[model samples]
Target: MSRFITIKDIARKLDISVSTVSRALRDTYDVNRETREKVLAMANALNYRPNFNATGLVNRSSHNLAVILPFVTNYYFSAVITGIQEVAYQQDYNIILHITNDSPERERAIIKNLAASNLDGLLVAISSDADACAHFQQVIDSGVPIVFFDRVPDAIKTSKVMQDDYNGAFDAVEHLIGRGYQKIAHIGGPQGLGFTRKRKKGFLDALAKHGLPVNEEWIIHSGFSREDGEADALKLLKQKKRPDAIFAANDRKAIGALMALKKSGIKIGAQMGIIGFTNDPASTIVSPTLSTIAEPAFEIGKRSCELLLKHISKRNFIPEEVILPGTLIERESTLR
Candidate 1:
């Protein structure tokens, strides 16, 4: 069997002490620049790779992070993962992904089992049905730092990063109003999620600001799936007084609304308008396109990872909340 090259092998080849090679490889400030450069060159030539297991054994740090999310099939979640991976790669940390499929039971199982993984930290976007975050508290108390993003839970006291859902929803509604759509409706996500509540509040506030009637029936709460959107849209369109425009919580729901409206023989962008949050690629692909709010999903992921790293490095670091703004992208779906 071929043995892997180690720092000691590079040190011997360069006639230097193993400690010197170790410090040089880590780019420690105490090492001489020339010596560090020479050590790096020799290590590269010898294909020397540090044994992370040994390092972890000595330092009690696994240098690995866990990212638990509802799912990654959507553009927003996938893009967020990309952002997180980029930062993890740069920081020489490994990321372990766990998908809960939006099941609270599955999320609980994952969190409950994370204590044995020796993870340095955790970044999560909790499942919609997660009513309690006591499992997360157990993980935190066990010394694994956690930072949440996007679909964070209110019950958790950890750091969180997310887009400005309230402002995004407000902007989507106000834009629809500006386009001359009076009877506006909203298709929101599960009411339990923090972002969902924020978006709903924004929608309600915007309607009140414009003196529009608050039809409780017009605000439908459901899952964040296109199918959920379609179902809610059908219910609203079948009403005695149908809405003239719809503002969906996310692009997937918006596209679903479009499908329902098109099926009902309603002329989109003319007799009716549709707007959504999260500029998913499907938004542009759907016929007539989708006018919506573009969230900083990637930025949210990066910031969450950064915050978790901070907590990992400084155990006493106080938790913080970071909210990034979303931009409105006007498209053919809402054009007059």
Candidate 2:
């Protein structure tokens, strides 16, 4: 006899049909209690262990979901992972994490090699430079549901969850204006991202709303890094007409700007005001604490997972676009 026992062995020992033994082992309500007891007794005697792989094949479910995103070391992404794990544990599902290192090529490679049978769904946050959605479209064509969170692509029609970038940027710029600072400039993220464009529009709209002059040279687009922020700030400082205030795309950049301004012997708040999005903890740790718009990262993860699960359960579920609001935190950086 084989060392590994199967349900067929139990069925034979109990003189019952294979289907009957399967139902009894599953504890289905339709199976009679007497038959179920016999089947259980036989299974125990035969040391029968069910194979999850076989069961998954029969049920067409793996109970596994994948999350692909950039930079897990980032504060915002780490917080989002925590929220995702919470929901996965409660629902008895497993999560498979894939890091793209913020590279479009890596993102595409991961999507290309996904094993459809091993994953029921996916949660994605596209790379900053991802300009195409055909790779994502292939996944959808293969019948795997996807729910995109922050930094999502616009080409595909699917469920998405993210912060209100436009409103957050608008509020950040308006706050600077309210503090009696004019000649405001913006340091934005990569141009390929939708959220970055939205933030830029908000910055321009806010300036136009107050009839403030828009200086094209003052607006700079670059990567979302503290180094980028510092470099962009230095470039602005060198300009003949320097901005009295700046609004960075994120907190890391704002802190970078802070460092540059301090090094240049410029007063942080009085001489120049600065604000950023994403209230990272480093905002408080830095000198002259940075003001920022706080994103609901954890909530975005939880909702994204929940929405993905819904799509898994019902393939025909209509896609939803969820936009969560961000809160503005005033700190020393913006204080006049």
Instruction: For model 2, give the 10-residue run with minimal summed lDDT.
Output: 49-58
For candidate 1, write residues 1-336 as lDDT tens digits: 468776778878999998888878768789999999999899779765443554453346678899999999999999999999989888878899999999999999887777546789999988898878898888888888899999888887889999999999999999999999999999999888889999999999999999999899999999999999999999998899989999999999999989888988999999789999999988889998999999998898889889998998789999999999999999999986
RMSD of 1: 2.6
lDDT of 1: 0.89
lDDT agreement with native, every candidate: 0.89, 0.91
Q: Which candidate number would show the highest lDDT if scored against the true structure?
A: 2
Count of steric clashes across candidates, in order: 0, 0
Span of 10 residues, lowest total lDDT, candidate 1: 49-58
Write one digit per residue (lDDT tens) for candidate 2, span 167-237.
99999999999999999999999999999999999999999999999999999999999999999999999
TM-score of candidate 2 against the unseen true structure: 0.86
